[model samples]
Target: MTAITGTVYDSSGQPVEGVNIQWSSNEDPPVSSHERGSRTIDDGSYRLVLHRGSWDVHGTKDGTGTEVETVVLGADDAVVDLHFP
Candidate 1:
């Protein structure tokens, strides 16, 4: 397993708290891969643990935002900051 950490931000360069973060593996054939999610804290920081693999990560806030990224996690931890505009 691997751990991913990052902070969410808005277009105004301010930290966005309580945003929902969703991630799903992009494996071939789309088998029953593990999908995980988490929400940012008051400080706009979040951490999630998932199996080592490639994933498509997305962050949504207030139904009018978009922040997306692709990440590959290895045995070690990873960091991915999401910024919504």
Candidate 2:
């Protein structure tokens, strides 16, 4: 089990708020790779639990930009920093 942790920010270099994050598998349909889930927080940060597999992680603030990240993780903590414009 690995904890994918990261912080979210906007183009202005300010941390975003009320953002939505999702962690999914690298499959075509991309199943929910996070056991706890793909969600966001008020402080613009998120942590998703992932197993040993490839994942497609992304984040967005309603009405803001969206980011798509492809990561291959193993028995290590993955740090995925998110930024949007």
Best by TM-score: 1
lDDT of 2 at 60: 60
Candidate 1 C-alpha error for residue 82, in Å: 0.4
Model 1: per-residue Cα lDDT over 2-84, one tens digit each: 89999998888788898888887777754234333689999989998888878877788778555678888878898999998
lDDT of 2 by residue, 1-85 (tens): 7888887888886777667776678866665554335555666778877777788787765666557788888889998888895
Q: How does model 1 fare in lDDT?
A: 0.80
What's the CA RMSD for each of the models?
A: 2.1, 3.0
Candidate 1: C-alpha RMSD to true structure equals 2.1
